[model samples]
Target chain A: MESILQSLISGIVVGSIYALIALGFVLIYKSTAVINFAQGELLMFGAYLCLTLVVVLQVPFWLAFLGTLIAAALLGFFLERLFLRPMIGEPAISIIMLTIGLASLMQGIIHMTWGSETRVYPAIFPVEPLRFGGMVVSQVYLYSVLFAVVCLILFNLFFRYSSSGIAMRAVANDQQAAQSMGISIKKIFAIAWAIAAVVAGVGGILIGNINGVNASLSSFGLKVFPAVILGGLDSIPGAILGGFIIGLLEALSGMYLDPLFEGGSKEVVPFVILVVVLMIKPYGLFGTEEIEKI
Target chain B: MAVKCGVFKTTYRDDEAIWQTKVSKFWLALLLIALLAFPFVFQGSRYLLYVVNSVFIAVIAAIGLNILTGFTGQISLGHGAFMGVGAYCSGYFMTTLGMPFLVCVVAAGCVTAIVGMIFGIPSLRLKGLYLAIATLAAQVILEFVFVRWRGVTGGSQGMLVPPASIGGLTFNSDFKFYFLALAFTILTVMIAKNIVRTKPGRAFMAIRDRYISAEIIGVPLFQYKLISFGISSFYAGVAGSLWGHYIGIITPEHFNVMISIQYLSMIIIGGLGSIHGTIMGAVFMTLLPEVLRVISGLFSGQYPVLVNIFGAIRESVFGLVIILFLIFEPDGLAARWKTIQNYWKLWPFSY
Candidate 1:
C-alpha cells in the first residue's frame, strides 16, 4: 500500500509534465488537423536553446526561460510559414510525411549543434523534498505539477474568454464557417503553432530540470501519443486527464510488474494501453467522433 | 528498321498486355541482359557488387512497402518489424530445423504475412493517421518481443544466420550472394508487377483512391486490406530473409523505425504507386549514402572536419531532399522520367 501511494504520487508528477507536452500536440492537431511528429524535436530544441543561453551566454535563468519561449514561438511560426504552408491542401499521408521529414531535419540540426551527449541544466529550484504524512515529494516535481496546473487553467480561461482563442477554436470547428465569419485560418494556424511551441518550451524546461537534456528527450513526443490518444486527440482537458492516467499507469506497472519481467515493462505499458485504447476506444474518451461522408 | 509513329490497342487483352509494344519488349530484354551482365562486368569491384546487392534487397523491401502504402494507400510504420520477423524466422529455421535456404525463405515470408495480417486487424475500424499509429504499436510490440524472447531471438545480441546454400553451391562471398539477391529481386519484382496489374491490384487502387466508393462498388474492404498487408509483409519477409543470408547474421537493430521511414521515403520519392518508380526509389535511397561517402571522401583529404560530421550532414541532406521532393515533385521520379521520355519523344515537332 505504501509503495503504491509512492508510485501514484511520482506518476502524477510525471503525468503533469506529459500533459503539458501533450497540450502542444492537441493545439496543432485541433487547428490544422496535422499531427506534428516534430513536437518532440521542438521540445528538445527549446531545452537546448535555453541551456545554451543560460550556460554559454551567462543569461539569468528567468530571462533565459522567457527567451526560450519567445524563440520557440518564432521558430514555430517560421516553420509553419515555410514548410507547412505549401502543404496546406495535400493528402494526409503527405502532411504526415512532411512532419516526419521536419522531425528528421530538426533532429539533425540538434545533433550538429549539440553533440549527442546529455547535459544537465543549472539548478533553478530548491533541492528539498516536501513531506506529506508518510509520503515525500521532490520540490522540482511539485513545481512541475504546479506549473502544469497553472498553464492548464490559464489556457482554459483563454479559450473560454479571449477573442483570439475563440477565433482559433472557431477555425478548428469549421474552416469554411470561420472564414465566412472573417477569422483568418492562416493566422489561426500560425498562432496555434506558436502557442503550441510556447507550451512545449515550458514543458521542456520543466522536464530538463528533472532529467538532463539530450537528443533522446525528443522521445517524450512519442510518449505524448498515448496520453493524447487516451484523453482524446482534440480535447485539451482530455490531454491533461490522459497524461495523469498514463503517468500513473507507468508508475504502477513499473513498481509491481518490473520484477516479474526483470525490467522494461514501464516503457511498454503505455503502448500496450495505447493498443488497447485503439482497439476498444479509438476515438478516445473525449475525442469527437468523425463522420465520413460519401 | 522502320520507326512506328504510334501504336494502338484493339482489344482488352492488347490494352492489358504487360508490354504494350514490340519496342517495349525489346527494351525489356535489353534491360534483362544488362542486369545479367552487371555482376560479371563488375567482377573486379567487390564493393560495387556489394552495393548493388544491397540495392537489390532494398528494391524488394521497397516494392513490398509500395504495394501497401503506394498502391493500397495504407500507410504502415511496422514494415521494419515485419522484416525482422522474416529474418528471425529464417534464421531460426536454418539453425534449428536445418531447413534448406529456399524453403526457409518461403516459410519466413508466410510467417511474416500472417503476423502482418494480424497487426492489420485494426484497419477494419481505423483509417489514416489513426491506422498509422496502430501499426506503430505493432512495431513497438514486435521490437519488444525481439528483445525479450531470448530462447529464439537470442535476446539483444541477435542470431547468427548460416550462409545460404543450394544442393552443391554455398554463397559465402559477395560475388556469390550477388546472383542470389539478383534472382530473388527479379522474382519479387515480377510477382509484384503481376499483382498490381491484375484484379486485386485494381481493387487496391480503388481502395486507395477512395475506400468508401470502393466498398460501395462491392469491394470487400476487410479482405482486400488484409490481402494488401499479407502481400506487403510477404515481400518484406523475403527481402529480410535474403538480407540475413547475405549478411550471415540477424539482429533486431537491423530493422528499426528508421529503416521503416527510409522505405516510406523511397516510395514517396520514387512514385508511390508505380512499380518502375519503386525500383528507382530503392536504387536512389541505397546509393545516396554511397554518393555522400564519395563526395565526403573527396573533401575529407582537404578538410578533416568533413569526416567528423559526415553522419550529421547525411541526415540533414536526406531530410532536405525529402522536403524538396515533396514540395517540387510530389508525383516523384517516375513522373519526371515519363515527362523526360515524352519530351524526347515529342522533340522537333512539339506542340
Candidate 2:
C-alpha cells in the first residue's frame, strides 16, 4: 500500500512536467494544426539555455530561467516567421516534413553548441525529503509539481481573459471563420508559437529539476505524442490530464510489467495505449470531430 | 534497323509499347544485360556486390513505400518498422523452424502484410498528421518488441541470418546475393508498375486526389485503401527479407525512423507518383550519404569543425534541397532530368 502510494506520488511529479510539455505541444498544434516534432528539442534548448546562463555566465537561477524563456519564445516566433509561415497553404506532407526538418535543424544546432555530454543541473530547491505519514517526496520533485501547476494556472487565466488568448482560441476553432471575425490568423500563429515556447521553457526547468539536463531530453518530445493523443489534440485541459495518466502508466509499467516482460517493454507501453486509443477513439477524450468536405 | 517503328510512331498501346520509348528499350535492355554481367566481370569482389545488392533492396522498399504514400496519398512514417517486421519474421522462420529460404521470403512478406493491415485499420479514418501519428505509433511499438522479445527477436543485438539457397545451392557469395536482390527488385518493380496501371491502381489515384469525391463516385474506401496497404506492405516485406538475407545479419538499428525518412526523401526527390522517380530516388539517396561522406572527408582536414558541421550540413542541405525542389521543380529530380534529356534529344530542331 505504501509502495503504491509512493508510486502514485512519484508518477504525479513526473507527470506534471510531461503535462506542461504536452500543453506546449497542444497549444502549437491548436493554432497551426501541425505537430511540432521540434517541441522536445525546444524544451531541451530552453533547459540548456538556462544552464548556460546559470552555470557559464554565473547568472542567478531565476534570471536565467526568465532569459531562457524569452529566448525560447523568440526562437519559436522566429520559426513561425521563417519556416512555418511558408507552410501555411502547403500540403499536410510539407508542413510535417518542414517541422521534421526544423527538429533535425534544432538537433544539429544543439549538438554544435553543446556537445552531447550529460550535465548535472544545480538544484535550486532544498535537498531534504518532505515526509508525510508513510510517504516521502523529494523537495525538487515537489517544487516541480508546484511550479508547473502555478504556470498552468497563470496560462489558464491568460486564456480566459486576455484578448490575444481569446483570438488564439478563435483561430484554433476555425481559421477562416476566425479571420472573418477580424482576428489576424497570422498573429495568432505567432502568438501560439510564442506561448508554446514559454510553456516548453517552464516544462524544461521543471524536467531539469527531475531528470537533469541533456540533449536526450529532446526524446521526451516524442514521448509527449502519446500523452497529447490520449488527452485529445484540441483540448488543453485534456493534455494536462493525459500527461498524468501517461506518466502514471509509465511508472506502473516500469515497476510491475517490466520485470515480467524483461526486455524494456514499459518504454513502449504508452505507444501501445496511443495506437489502441486512436484506433478506438479517433477523436480522443475531448477532441471535436472534424467534418471534411469533398 | 527495322525497329518496331509502327509501335513507336504517334502512339502505342500499353501492351505494345516498348520499355518507355522505342529508343529507350534498347538502352534499358543493354543496361540490364550489362548489370547482370558486371558482377561476374568483377572477378567476385564481394564488397561491390554487397553495395549493389543493397541498392536493389532499397529500391524494393522505396517502391513499396511509394505505393502507399504516393499512389494512395497515405503517409506512412513507420515503414522502417514494417521492413524490420519482415526482416525479423523471415530471419526467425529460417533460423528456427528451418524453413526453406523461398518459404521464408513468402512468410516474411505475409507476416508484414498482416501487421500492416493491423496498422492500416486506423488509417481508414485518419488522414494528414493524424495518420502519420498512427503509423509512427506502430514504429514505436515494433521497436519495443525488437528490444524486448529476446526469445523471438534476439533483443537489441538482433539475429544472424543463414546463407539462403534456392533448392540446394547456398548464396554464400556476394555475387549470388546480388543476383538474388537484382532479380527480386526487378520482379517487384514490374509487379508494382502493372499494379499502378490497373483499375484498382486508378482507384488509389482517385482516392489520393480526393477521398470524399472518390467515395461519392462509388469507390469503396475500406477495400481499396486496405488493398494499398496490403500490397505496399508486401513490397516492404519482400525488400526487408531480401535485406536480411543479403546482409547475412539483421539488427533493430538498421530500421529506425531515420530509415523511414530516407525512404520518404527518396520518393520526394525522385517524384512522388512516377515509377521512374521512385527508382531514381532510391538509387540517388542510397548513394548520396556515401558520396557526401567521401566528399566531406576531402575537406574535413581543412575545417576542423567539419565533423561538427556534418549533421547540420546534411540536415539543412537536405531540407533546403526538399524545399527548393518543391518550389522550383516540384516534379522532382527524375521528371526534371527527363525533360532536360528530351531537350537534348531534340537539339537543333525547335518543336
Q: After TM-score superposition, what is the CA distance of residue A164 in candidate 1 from its true location, in Å?
A: 1.0
The residue-by-residue lDDT of candidate 1 on B1-351, one tens digit each, is: 554444567899999888877767888899989988988899899899999999999999999999999999999988999999999999999999999999999999999999999999889888988888888878888888888888999988989999899888999988999889988888889999999988999999999999999999999999999999999999999999989988987888998887888898999999999999999999998999899999999999988977877887788888887888889999899999988766655554445
In Å, residue A185's CA in model 2 sits off its true spot by 2.0
Q: In DockQ terms, which candidate is top?
A: 1
TM-score of chain A of each: 0.97, 0.97
Per-model tally of clashing residue pairs: 0, 0
Q: Write the per-residue lDDT of candidate 2 for residues A171-222, one digit (tens) a residue.
A: 9888999999999898989989988888888888778767788877988888
Of candidate 2 chain A, the 10-residue stretch with the lowest lDDT total is: A93-102
Docking class of 2: acceptable
Residue B279, model 1: Cα distance from true site in angstroms: 0.8
Off by over 4 Å in 2: B1-18, B37-48, B303-331, B341-351
Root-mean-square deviation per candidate: 1.6, 2.9
The segments of candidate 1 whose C-alpha lies over 4 angstroms from its true place after superposition are B1-3
